[model samples]
Target: GVLPLAGLGAWVAGAGPVVLPLVIACFGLVAWGLHRRRARADCGETKIHKEGVKP
Candidate 1:
């Protein structure tokens, strides 16, 4: 979950060039998105139950 944030910190701290951290952050974002989707599905929150309401 903290991968992207850590990568951003690394980049800001000058740990390496911007390219590498950006690549890592991109991958981290994808991974976090997948994880969040799976979690939402597990919680039965993948769809809206009605107008102005979420499930």
Candidate 2:
């Protein structure tokens, strides 16, 4: 989880200050992907419901 990653990053920070941005970017990408997937799923469900399909 992010907590463990945060702790590890804190330790790593003592050596350098580059991993933080990489970690943040990775989380941002993951969040964006999940949001897009959910939006697509909702759109599909709406279409199915509108068509009277019992989903």
Candidate 3:
């Protein structure tokens, strides 16, 4: 949230025009990766439970 806000502020402040977009893109990619990782972890847990694994 801070990073995104910084990016927006920088753009509004007229700091390079490319800065905001790049920051947004990077933030999005990171968020997406994290989400995918969480989904995979959940799936793995479900599979383990289905297999009757004691954990």
lDDT of each: 0.76, 0.86, 0.85
Q: Against the true structure, whose TM-score is highest? A: 2
Better model by lDDT, 1 or 3? Answer: 3
Every model: Cα RMSD to truth? 8.1, 3.5, 4.2
Write one digit per residue (lDDT tens) for candidate 2, span 1-55.
Answer: 7999798867778657676678789989999999999999999999988888654
lDDT of 1 by residue, 1-55 (tens): 8999897777767755757768779989999999999998866753544533743
Q: After superposition, how far is residue 50 of candidate 2 from its true place, in Å?
A: 0.7
- Candidate 2: the clashing residue pairs are none
Q: Which sections of candidate 1 miss by over 4 Å?
A: 1-16, 45-55
Name the TM-score of candidate 3: 0.66
Candidate 3's C-alpha runs over 4 A off are 1-14, 53-55
Candidate ranking under lDDT, highest first, comes to: 2, 3, 1
* Shift of residue 3 alpha carbon in model 3, Å: 12
| Residue-level lDDT for 53 in candidate 3 | 70
Q: Which one is best on lDDT?
A: 2
Please identify model 2 stretches exceeding 4 Å from their true place.
Answer: 1-9, 53-55
- Considering summed lDDT, which 10 consecutive residues are worst modelled in model 3? 11-20
TM-scores of the models, in the order given: 0.48, 0.70, 0.66
